[model samples]
Target: MDHKAKHILIVGGGYVGLYTGLRLQRALRRELKSGSVRITVIDPQSYMTYQPFLPEAAAGNLSPRHVVTPLRRVLSKVRIRNGKVTKVHHANRSVTFEPNAGPSEEIEYDVIVMAAGSISRTLPIPGLADAAIGFKSVGEAIALRNRVLALLDRADSTDDEEVRRRALTFVVVGAGFAGVEALAELEDMARDAVKYYDRLSEKDLRWVLVEASDRILPEVGPEMGRWTLEELRERGIEVKMKTLLKSCEGGHVVLSDGDAFESATIVWTAGVKPSPVVNAGDLPLDERGRIMTTTKLTVSGTNGAFAAGDVAGVPDVTNPGQYCAPNAQHAVRQAKVLADNIVRHLQDRPLREYRHKYAGSVAGLGLHKGVANVYGVKLHGLPAWFMHRTYHLSRVPTVNRKVRVVADWTLALFFKRETVSLGEIESPRDDFRAAAATG
Candidate 1:
């Protein structure tokens, strides 16, 4: 057996990348220690965010720091590079890496794992890039939390009715898990926060959810989706289904239904497409720009190349003629198979195919409110909400993060939700710059 050293390069540090690296480091511990196997993970961010908790973090139900795990700490045995893969030249077994600073360089590898995940799929709507925010990253979540609270403060301090009204209206686009949960959780937080304000009440706040599709939470089936819609509407949230956001020019929302309103906050969570980095490679891609992979998680017609998670179109053998849904459930499970296969490939052993049954879906609407359909059993309201938190808590990666998140929730039971906005953190240098100028 040739024990020559081999370098494996993972393209993204998201769910798939982090988990695969973790598994490989542990499984190939001897090889890694002996310098026979080298693994390098390249990502723009140093931490992998538990995206399921982004809504809770934004709602002040959980701390933003607790929702992310540092890649260095978790993948201690693997080399971590804080950079983005600008291009993947799989034909040459190298990729172009662009660091946070300086020039781009090419990184060669023996095995390349295209775990680069998806990004928010947005339209070219007018003023969208400037007026709207995405709910993808931890930074975006924290910024949004501050933005919502700061808007509340602005509305309270303003004398003009128009300004107050605009500041009070919040619009969330999309009705999927991200959009719905963010809207519900933030609305709950704002409703609770209004009690502390002298002039503001829950009645003054307008929460609108715009969905181009007729149904929301379609993953949970139509019955549960309809139930969620009713529950949100019962809470005074206007659910505009089958309606499109025509434009949000200058914070003024123009809907396809001919309704117009002013909202200071517009959240976009409609959909996500494969990362553009995939296209820069010579690998074969599907029509949707996702890397085409077999049931075994290996890149189609390519050796020493694998892909999983949102970036890969992995065939679901369990559900014939369909690809696995790009979700955390599939990503986490696929990582285990991918890591094992990499080891198997290295050892000249047969690789195992990746297959898993769909475990339904659970979504938290707000505190004590949720909907779930697990293995044909349906649950709603408090039970579903509890399941939502419990499931995500169990899946949040490290024990440290799980413990911290639990502590936050435990404290929330005794204390009121934090409503203070730390918008200044976004630009910490602003105050110092002003003071220096005066001096």
Candidate 2:
């Protein structure tokens, strides 16, 4: 391979792709300036979302725009392409991407970094595709917030008992961090929003949390998880354990535990699987369809091809016989190691193994309420809530975004959360198109 000018193609622009490109832009600064190497990042979106803040965004505590970082602005030296890689011909050292407004194009590279991340893991539940919404992106978070507030408006304006009950009941499936936090935050928001309605009381709103697993928040340990369940139940939120969402047709939800309910909002946060990019080419994938990578973050038995983050099944060096769990904490740290290893590989230097200990987790139940188990220390209530804010604020990516998020929080201290829902934003051209057709 010629060492004159190398092209490093980074696929996906989420946690792994964006962070890896940022680190590479700095580590290869001299090489980039001297025209010895060039980096290109490709993704469908122009920005990388900080997913940890999705729940707060949904609950109206944070602005939706502030939780995401623009990639082109963050990595100025690295070329940015807003498109989707439809195919990867690794052996030919080339990839095909379909641009947003142009025909599909192909580009060849000297090195490839596959960090396409994951998508919402869905099931074949009846009416799921049409009735349920997945909680993954900032758009979904904002849409959910709007939907929740819109439901409140619907309930307050309605006179029929059935219509009001259906509009006020909210259902959330899954018991992981995403589902738990989303449910807790929205429940708190709804309870607060009710205070402004003369006809609606807290009892008028029904919140249901259905989990297929035996317990919720498995990441925070059994003790904390149990306590969280009790707390939510104390707030009148139904905690249905060992239950499954059998069907949700026309806003009628049927659960496995012989319970039936009507709800206008259903949020699905079951889990995530590797992105479709995992099968973009003939890459070796594990049972879960993740690209198989060695502990060094290199594709097994392949040269000049590497992968990390949720899309790659990277063996955990800290754990004897397990692969790293797909999470932001792992993805952020893995990118640094992955970028360093890629640079070492280019420079013909010995690569170092990636390893890190689990640092534990923190979760916010609602405003000024949380639970955290960090490094064997467990905390709850106000202290845990403050820690959750502090930790994520520090890791929100880019100084500007961090500042904006803090400003939002600081402003929240003096003001109330905005409860107005602009559902028309989703269909801005509806009235215009209707009038034009009638004319």
Candidate 3:
């Protein structure tokens, strides 16, 4: 093989991008050091969020800072570009890169990996874009925590019945794992927080969950899903099945089932679609807008190009006629195979096919409450909750982050969860601007 220098560009710094870059830097250390190979990772943010911990971060079970791993620190050997890939001209072996500031430029690469993950899937429900918040990133999680606590404060300070009722009512849309865990965790936090307020109690708060489908947590199978539904209902949470949010204009929520109410807090965790960046390239894509890839993790019909994780429709060889589910389990495992295949391709060696059997799912409902179906064994309540924490803790990226998360969890055991609102952080210049106007 020629010893000419080669540049490998990885788009998006999420699970696949980070892990693949980390592995490539390690696997090709000599080549990298000798200037024979180079790797660059680009994303809007400089860190990779450990998404499974987002709910816990919102609930104060984990620190927000610990929920993300800095890409630069993790991929030290690779170049990190904190920006966006506006367009990919694969036919010309280059992409249009837009940095956080300044003009956009085109970057040429010998090989490209499309790991730009998915975004929150939303609908055209009335007032959704303005009134509802998503539960995807760390910023959203922190903002949600602050919003809930702020609303609680408002409810306690006011004597108006209608205002208090609106402030205390919380509505969460969708019933998937993200929705269930978020609702459960936030409810637990709010219930504990009410103890500190003289005029507020658990009874004053109303938590409602709406699902267009008949069941929630469908990933855990029907039996476990039923158990979760009953558990939420027993806790005084209104679980509306086969119902849709027809409108939520200006905090007034209307349902498809003809129910209407006023709520100050509305959370949307319905679903996710492939990142729009996938559409900016001439790559072969499936009907669902995901980049198409073979079992070996290489982009279909494209040389020196690859894709994995939520953005790629990787065929599941273990299950005939099915593509791998877009989840952390598949994404993490696929990263390993993707990195190896890239190296194998470089060395002119036969690439290994990516295949992994489906493992069961685990989700934390709240503190000491969860459900799990690993392999064929099923668990519920406390045992499953322990498994949920244990499994995710083991998967968190770095030793530094893992230790910090464990420390946060350890402190929570002996102390009460913090319930303070820092909503002002979202708009830090507001107070300064007000002072300037007064002067």
lDDT of 2: 0.91
Cα-based lDDT for every prediction: 0.94, 0.91, 0.93
Off by over 4 Å in 1: 1-4
Candidate 2, 188-236: lDDT as tens digits = 9988898988899999889999999899898888888998988899999
Report the alpha-carbon TM-score of model 2 versus the true structure. 0.98
- Which lDDT tens digits does candidate 3 get at residues 238-296? 99999999999999999999999999999999999999999998999999889999999
Candidate 2 Cα outliers beyond 4 Å, as residue runs: 1-4
- For candidate 3, list the clashing residue pairs, or say none: none
Arranged by lDDT, best first? 1, 3, 2
For residue 373, give model 3's deviation from the true position in Å.
0.7
- Return the TM-score for each candidate structure: 0.98, 0.98, 0.98
Model 3 vs truth, CA RMSD: 1.4
Worst 10 residues of 1 by lDDT: 1-10
